[model samples]
Target: MKLLKLTLAVALICLVSCAEKGSRDTAEKETAVTEAPAEKAFKYWTWITADPERTDDSYQEEFAKYKDNGLDAVLINTNTDPELLGRLTPLARKAGLEVHAWLMAMNRPGDSVALQHPDWYAVSREGKSCFDHRPYVDYYQWLCPTRKASRNHVLGLVEGLAKVEGVASVHLDYIRFSDIFLPIGLLPKYDLEQEEELPEFDFCYCDVCVAEFEKIHHKNPREMENPALDIEWKQFRLNKIRAVVNDAYEIAHKHGKILTAAVFPYPEMADHMVRQRWDKWDIDVVLPMIYHNFYNEEIDWIGFATKQGVQDLKYKDTELHTGVYVPEMSPSEIKEAVQLAKENGAKGVSFFDGPALTDDMLQAIKETKEGR
Candidate 1:
């Protein structure tokens, strides 16, 4: 009887203990769920070109203005100059700013590597290579993403920049095929209708890409009646670029650095235009070039584009920073754009460049920074 009584008493104690433990666990989970997440930080960044005058002293002078205006980072097109990066790192850090290596990945303008391997340049559907005949822009010399040599050449540049001391991140630009469909505003200037996919602008029909596509589907892309409508072929090109970008992401993460890209405003439209499926690219952050004027869009389009990118990345870990072109925009217009970006869930905002910005534009950016 004593043993039975003792067993019942122990079971009762255990029941009470388990109930208390369960209540505590529920309370803890409730606290965790209700606790507010840390506020997202607002960052300001701008792009700069490293001209001959951008020496150590000049760099210091340039960074001082950025620091004074509450800028947090600067993306500089430093090429593969480790020496210059070595010099600029401490200076930028001293000025309370971070330096990101701005690199042109697929678009290698005057690239000595591409110059040597002329076959590495992407060929249009019309059998024209970017090497001999430049695309819409004289400098739009794009490399074929499927070629092993092209991948190695670009990755070598990225790896070198990653090894640079104090480079906060490697910002990739022009990491897409030449635009198959130019923006509507640009079409008039280029004298293109582009109601349908034009053979001249469509690209990446180089020997390697052709052979691979044929091997996959047992068909040639060039023979397709409407190559643009060939979803499999289009996905092939998208995957090729995605592979290169993923390799870059791995390289950056392996060295403990962030990998970012300057992408087109909308993923679906970007896919149709540039074959840049950046939504699938494994990147830490993306700065969509949400330049309204380029797209012939209004100021409010900034919010819409930013919101679209945010929604696309809602399931991913990537952060979005909207890139604003400040050339033709007024100070008030710029402020409104920044507000739109913030309201639409942008973590930060980046201006297209530093050299083009005037005092008024800078003051407007300052106003945005001060929350005025």
Candidate 2:
């Protein structure tokens, strides 16, 4: 009986000790999981205009500076020159930066091939072709997205860039109609007021666009007295832009690349101001140029705009990266802008231009990236 009791006691002790050990192991695993760091998904990007005249060594140095300061990607405007993009791609990749071929999609300022086709240019509501009259800026030589030739020309450029080795995306800039309403702060610079959609600024009333709209809606947009009030007319233009973007997306994917665009602030604002409804388009990423100073808005407006875009894209796979204008911002404001963008659910923040980022601004970005 004593031996049996001793055996039972030993078994009880072993069972309790094993249970305690199992509990301790579970606690250790739980602690480990609790202490494990979350993976960082936020990215940093910058827009840069590439100069063919610059030496490779110079570009290498520039790219290295951007990378060292926490930039992960660069949208390089090579003036739609795929060869230039191809030349710069490897160099940027060598410096640990992802390369994006940035093209001025609809606004082809001095496109040699496009300049040969005047009919492809967008016509204003006042019957002035952007081919010559050019809108508020001389560079606003936007093409009519509804025109097959012009759109194909733009898609061809996208395909050319997509073919470049190691390019992350074919970045389309100026993908919308020429702004019907200029930013409020910029209105003074242009010496004008935009209380209404001025005929001079309203666009794509070209014969092709008119005919296309008439065919679809059985009414001519040009015949409408107040075309701005015509919902179908506005929707037609918006759909035209969306079509171009969707086609570009397909072209990019065909070459195993993604399509990205530098768009206006948000869907509703974009549609109202520029006939662009980016949220409805098929794209991989949309970096909205939420430059608050352009609208005479406060810094916190960046967060507001970022959150708006993020909410609009909640169901989309398209990522939103808030694009900030660094030229007018101080170092402290830069940090605040980055934090606001993060807090508002931006996947990343991109500076307007790489050259505009001062050392202090870069340091601010670096520190913000390091969580310092």
Candidate 3:
């Protein structure tokens, strides 16, 4: 009877222990299942370097730090380097960061390619086929977008970048006309040979572009805008840009990757400065560089302009990301701008991106999220 009692007690204890263990296991799983998703993060892009390791000596180390400090994505200008990207993909994955290829679509050849293919260059208003060295700037040349050769070169480059494994997106920058903002000076530079009486509307009136435009419109822009150019002819110049952007979209979409553009803030600035029709293209995302200081009085106009650009461009459904110069303002002020963008219906904002990312700024992003 004593042995029987002892055996029964041991069996009861084992049953209770098993039940308790099962309960603990269930509680742990429930706790884990209840954890929320990570906070949506801000994206970053670099226009300077093509190599990400050159981006920071320790790529993984820097991303781990950013992860700890809080940043969502990093876009490096590596659209030209598939082999290098091959090595960097594993590094980005290990660090838990999204990688992007930054392409200078129309802005070609800082030195090498332009020097080799001089004929591929755009012809300026003065009819200069090969651009003489500019006064202070280092950028030598840009390929004429209307040319099939130029278009193919850019498309091929993008396709190569698209093949890079682990690239989340391909970012198009300078995907427009030359951002040469001449003062529309009251008078042409005297001593300048054969200056026209009309204001120089800087642009790409390349031979190929002119031919395509004439085929579509049956008129020349110079003659119409010259009072000699009709409103329709002037508008045709803007349409050419849309054609290029749409072409790029087809290629990028076919590959199953998202296409995003870096554009100027206002609709007019986009059209005037770079001929980028932000309100037209159905890109996955559009990032307008609304550097308030650069726009002068247009500072207060940022929110309204962005909202209009988003809606007028028929991109109300598209993701909106504003590019801000982080160093120009205080964190609170930056936070207010982001709030303004969000209130005006932007999905998120991206900083111009060299700032140290102060704790206050992170808090502001946090606040922006909570307020939404």
Candidate 1: lDDT of 27? 97
- Tens-digit per-residue lDDT, 265-356, candidate 2: 98999999999999999999999999999999999999999999999999999999999999999999999999999999999999989999
Overall local distance difference test of candidate 2:
0.94
- C-alpha lDDT (0 to 100) for residue 64 of candidate 1: 86
lDDT, candidate 1, 124-216, per-residue tens: 999999998878889889899999999889988888888888888888998899999888878889877889888988989999999999999
Going through the candidates in the order shown, the clash numbers are 0, 0, 8
Summarize candidate 3's per-residue lDDT along 1-372 as a digit string, tens digits: 999999999999999999999999999998888886765444433232444546434776666654554456666665477787666766766777677677887777563554566656665554554355321144635667777777677777777777777877777887776654522221143223323323332455567767777888787654543532355644665676676777777777777778787887757767665556767775787878766755553445558766866676562455667777666677777777776676676666776663445667756655655553
TM-score, candidate 1, is 0.90
Q: Candidate 2: lDDT of 21?
A: 100
Stretches off by above 4 angstroms in model 3 are: 1-57, 133-136, 180-201, 221-229, 298-300, 314-316, 355-372
Error of 1 at 329 (Å): 0.6
CA lDDT scores, all candidates in order: 0.89, 0.94, 0.64
Per-candidate alpha-carbon RMSD to the true structure: 3.8, 3.9, 10.5
Local error of candidate 1 at 188, Å? 2.4
